[model samples]
Target: MMEAPCKRRRGDDDEDAGDRDRLNALPDSLLREVMSHMKARQVVQTCVLARRWRNLWRSMPCLDVDQDEFTTAGVSVVYSDHEGWERFEDFMDTLLCPGNVSIALLDTLRLHASSMGEDRRASRWIRRGIKYPHAGQEPGLQRGAPSCSSWRLRRLHLSNLYLCNLLAEHVRSRCPSLEDLELESCTCEFPAIASRSLKNLVLKRCALKGFREITSPPTEEPVYQWWL
Candidate 1:
């Protein structure tokens, strides 16, 4: 028997019901929780799966971006010279605060992209890392600004990143709510990233060029802490 003639596919709204069905069919929210834990690129690939998985990602909470995870995910990275910093740039563009997001349970932001800051591939990630939100604000950030203010962010971490001169000045004031903090193999130039409310903090192999911030021990105390 011949198949019926093809018709135009419905818009994403039509598919949203299907997405809800898939979300409903799940035994629990485990899938959503898992998706929340993965990188933005991994989440984008999931969007191509079906309407159900597509819409589900938008509601996810946790957002984590780092060189190792991006390298593992194999996104469209353009790095052959800055060491190994190519991968994370692709994600940093998609997941910044200005991006339209209804719910963002940002718990931890970490950067652990090897110690060779001058590596051609790695340096690009550092640049993108420094230049996100302001430079790569999705072009549509103006429309997304309302949603951007409601992000439920908790922790922000940076390791092995080389902050640009301009961004380095503003990093501290931008993400002050973060509690658990760690910096390793990073360069926070003069007038460094500061926070009045940090709980557990660690710094390892950092590079400071005649600039530093005084980090007072957590008065509230932490459950666990370690540094090298």
Candidate 2:
């Protein structure tokens, strides 16, 4: 007896079903190595992709954002879009946390939000993002005065965030693990950054009138320091 010939599936028929699932997923470490090549803006856009690729961004652990990218995301302070304000909040809610977070999770979060001072709250959050790039599921975290958490921060990038003695002091007291800190283009300054582990530090264009160094309890030396 002759049997009927078997038929192969069409390319579109097979592909339409679903993307081939990876049986043996690549190790997170290796996968991050590949994500390192992408810029922060590109990483943010990947959220719309499949869930597997959703969190693949935070794995970079190092976030780099330029001025233009900030503007495009509607995070620029110099510009204003009544509608963008609402959209920005919605956008932030989605980027709360990237599960694969680590201490060095976000080494640099360069936020170039302009110096717009109309809405204090929105400006503050923009500044916080640059200082801390770790993503989470929760949003609406407050900053300014006591924003410093017990977490270890490797680098902080802040611009145009006005601060008072209370906020400045809070960071100096809380960020125990901060290694590199930048207060560029902001009009605020910490009371004093007394961290012995601080290697690279910058305080530029800020009202650091009260900024100082904690020398009375000072013991070790700072690898790198700067004030401008």
Per-residue CA lDDT of model 2 for 146-187, tens digit only, reads: 233544456777666665554444446555666767876666
Q: After superposition, how far is residue 220 of candidate 1 from its true place, in Å?
A: 3.4
Worst lDDT 10-window in candidate 1: 143-152
- What would the per-residue lDDT of candidate 1 be over residues 105-196, giving only the tens digit for each residue? 34444445643544334445434434443332334323222233232235656666665554344334444455666666766555554555
Segments in model 2 whose C-alpha atoms lie over 4 Å from true places: 1-26, 33-39, 58-60, 65-67, 70-77, 80-89, 97-107, 126-149, 214-219, 223-228
TM-score of 1: 0.56
TM-score (C-alpha) between model 2 and the true structure: 0.59
Q: What do the candidate models score in CA lDDT, each in turn?
A: 0.51, 0.52
What is the TM-score of each predicted model, taking all chains together?
0.56, 0.59
